[model samples]
Target: MVRKHERLATAWAAGVAGVVFALLMAAVIVLVRVALPGGADGGDVTTDSGQRSAVRTALALLPFAGIAFLWFMGALREQAGEGEDRFVSTVFLGSGLIFVATLFAAAAAAGSVLGESPQSSDFGRRLTYTLLTTYAMRMAAVFIITTSTIGRRLGVLPRPLVVLGYLSGLALLVMGANVPWSELIFPVWALVLSLNILWGRRPASARPAAPA
Candidate 1:
């Protein structure tokens, strides 16, 4: 059976996810604006000031996705009831935590690349760019896969949404060869998943209501 605290937790998580999705969507807009004006000639793609700024903004936006994923997990856990196994919950939580960590790493790397003497050793440039891009895509993969798994098990998200989640996960997995595509996919999928979580009805708490 679902406990009162568990139900409350799920509702809170969903609310937080909704707010975070808005923030992340805003950040994506800011990033696109910042990145579009400059052509490829200014500097190395990774070290370019405009690109760095965009990456930083994107990184800052990732917490929303993380929060959304966490809330989805919370909802799933509550729905699973007492018979629900803990392994899936742990996987969801673990993946969400790692996703957040990767975002932090991406932010740091972007900052380093954008700092003064912007173009440093080629190795550092490549490393930073790789970290920012690769990790972002990987985190997207983790988010979609884990969430789809949890949603399937708990029957929280709609069927179409779950299918989209799987497709998004597969796209991210293959996105390594297409940087721009990965950038687009991550934010778009995150928004979709966030909306699904936020709009779903919350599981009921066990606590009885006081007399009206």
Candidate 2:
């Protein structure tokens, strides 16, 4: 009974954390893109008050998004329990940690513009975009792929979801650097997966009793 309760609690935690992370990440990406209409490859931006404010808001929310992502990752790993394959689990853990670190690094790069010279701002913007689109998203792709693989093996995720995860991962991996706003796919995927977990979770009473 206690184990069942713990599993249920973990599932709820994963769902909530994933949703929070997804929404916050999507909001941050949108705010940043809206503020920098020229995209990452564009020239240095004039420090318009509105754009600065948007960037600031995105930066402010970044840490919370990171925190929620960490919680979500941890909860999902907990769900895997002892049945998880060591190799895939290691890749999953590594990719997620790297993605978070790169994400923070990108955020720090973006934050530099809030108090720096125009030249510094330009450099920061470029660096932020590169880190986010190139490195972070690739890591995210790996994380997604590994997660999908794990889910498939564990039978936790449905076949369609597993396929969607693979497609999302592939898009992030192949087109994230070249295609604008491709990073949004990650949050969307996360949101869908989280919703599935939440909706599919069965009540303790619904489980068949263990052998006496």
Candidate 3:
């Protein structure tokens, strides 16, 4: 019963993290599109007002990610105690830690840029944007791959969902390779995984256990 509740809690955390991630992505996309093109005339673009707003919005979602990470770790610990191998769990934990660390680095970068004057050169602006996008995409790739591996080992997520997770991981890899369309894949994959978390379930208990 406690194990069941733990699974439920992990699923709930993942779902909530998905929602937060979606909102953060929306805000980021809006900020990027609106603030990137005009160079220095991009009022407050490189300053504390606009940059800080975007950074704060993104950072606000990090706690949800952290929650999901903790729940995942708990699940891993439980599985290890239940005699499952530790290799995949270790990978998941390591990759998740790396992903979270990147988020912190990205947040710091945004803060630094925002705290600066708005007179950055166009080349510098583009470089910064590209760096941010690349780092974010890499982090997403690591997270998807690790989570999908965990789902496969745990036997909790459905087969189709696991497949989609792999596909999403591949898409992130392709995006990291600089393909233009890979950007669309991450959010779609996130939405799919989130929905799975929201709706997936384990069998309910009844009167008695079946004979072995």
Q: Which candidate's lDDT is highest?
A: 2
lDDT of 1 by residue, 1-212 (tens): 46666665665665566456545745754573355323222344454666766756766666565566556555555555664447756766676667667655644554554555646423334554465457656765776777677777767678898898888888877776354535556557666666655555444363455589
lDDT per residue for candidate 2 within 52-142, as digits (tens), equals 9998999999999999999999999999999999999999999999999999999999987676588888888888888989999999999
lDDT, candidate 3, 1-212, per-residue tens: 99768767766666656655555555554554444434322445544466556545655654564455445445434433444447755765666566556555654454444445554333344444554457656766766776677677768668888888888877776666356435446556666766666665334463346689
1 or 2, greater by TM-score? 2
Window of ten residues with lowest summed lDDT in model 2: 38-47
**TM-score of every model?**
0.67, 0.93, 0.66
- Model 1 alpha-carbon miss at residue 53, Å: 5.9
User: Which pairs of residues have clashing backbones in candidate 2?
Assistant: none
Q: Residue 120 in model 3: shift from native, Å?
A: 6.2
Every candidate's CA RMSD = 6.5, 4.0, 5.8
The candidate that achieves the highest TM-score relative to the unseen native structure: 2
lDDT of 3 at 69: 44
Candidate 2 Cα lDDT to native: 0.91
Candidate with better lDDT, 2 vs 3? 2
